[model samples]
Target: MTRRPVPEYAPDRLTAYEVPLRTGDALRTPHDIAAILRTVHTGTHIYLRDKVGTVMGTTLFTGDPATVTPAPFTNDDWSLTLLRCLASPSTEELPEARLCGFLFLAPDRLRLYLATEEAPSGMTAAGVRPGGALTALLAALPALLDEQRLTTTDADDPHCARVVDLTDW
Candidate 1:
């Protein structure tokens, strides 16, 4: 059975972001959570990390956990669309997750929410950081997603925040 969809917004709150999709948007095949994830990444899961580990016994699946590979990057309008959605920070405060996809958005740091499935098409950026992912995205998405100037309220590093804008609906 299909599980009920996760709420687009947490109760009593709103996000600064908004996309073409709405809260009623379907979380199915072309527009599910992974769709958002893939949009954040584009065509690869390069953002996902599979760290090496030592096993004490043979009873565990000590290897990397496999994620379904994301689809192609045929969508030319993705970056522009996303940037526009995040262009304007709203006066109505929302859950942090809804605004930045990161938990916090500090003044100095910008919390980047790179989806796990947007790895680079090239083998060179396969595992190591793809230098152009953010650059390419920011350059292209300024107009389409002209919603807010996204910034983070934390030290410059990756970590989960308690709040973010999920109001991209």
Candidate 2:
């Protein structure tokens, strides 16, 4: 994957929210984001860009989410696609949801731009099919954000918190 300089997010724009650890589970913390990310197969990475177009850093998730493997993109490939979507005319009804970005961790470098009129709509990536582990995580994520109040201060675990708070969308 080609590495490029990621722009810094404005302090006012950076915000945090919570997502579910599991269905009906109430243990909400940014730390759990890594566990959710680990659901993806090895060599998979998720890029969550915000509405204002800010990318932070990359987290390498190296665990077995499922037996299947997803296709990998050559770094800039997915970024280019996301740029196209953002540049589209506002009048045009884009498939993108209000607070979402591209998801390109699927097999065969399968790229999908996940936008939701509301979040938790979720999308499939890599070999992680619609009902796969990744899909479940995405579906479960939005609800947690809606149900729980976010912590005002940064969590002690800065690394994992970075992954969870990566998106401003």
Candidate 3:
């Protein structure tokens, strides 16, 4: 892991979006999520959230898609396996699991939080600027999720205002 300064932003408020995932969507696997992260960042800390919205564990992801090892998808153990697999140098496959959401700490002072359709609150972001890495990733996600429309809520909106769980990821 490398040392880096934390980005500055208000923790109590954030801009939110709804990333709806229909059945058979490509964002279903850990590998898929890894690929998405690689597109916007060379390396990133990934925070995986469990059911009822809690941080289960986290791992550093810096692997090529082809080099990733494939693993069986099981709802019960996928999160633990994913943390172990990505942390290991030899094995690197994103196991299959229900991606309720992810908190991605990208390079260049960008912090983006994504909550899938399954989550109660939608996607939220802070410290995002136009044409920044975070902005670029947000733009690309709509298409990556098979062109699912993203509904946005302003940061000041009461409905959008919520506390985001922040980890090193």
lDDT of 3: 0.34
With a 3 Å backbone cut-off (N, CA, C), the pairs that clash in candidate 3 are none
Model 2, 1-169: lDDT tens per residue?
9997555664444533223344355553332444444334346455344312322432222323243242344334334433343445345565333333444444323223334444443432111122223334344443433332331223442212122221222
Model 3 residue runs over 4 Å out of place are: 1-108, 126-154, 157-169
Error of 1 at 126 (Å): 32
lDDT of 1 at 41: 44
TM-score of each: 0.17, 0.19, 0.17
Ten residues in sequence with the least summed lDDT for candidate 1: 121-130
What candidate 2 gets wrong by more than 4 Å, as runs, is 1-79, 86-99, 103-110, 116-169
Per-model lDDT: 0.32, 0.35, 0.34
lDDT of 1 by residue, 1-169 (tens): 9998656564323222112333356423433434554554445333223332223421121111134343444333343334344444343643122223422233222333432222222110001111225444444432323233332233333343211222231
What total of clashing residue pairs does each candidate reach?
Answer: 36, 12, 0
In terms of TM-score, which candidate is stronger, 1 or 2? 2
lDDT (0-100) at residue 26 of candidate 3?
52
Q: Please say which candidate is ahead in lDDT: 1 or 2.
A: 2
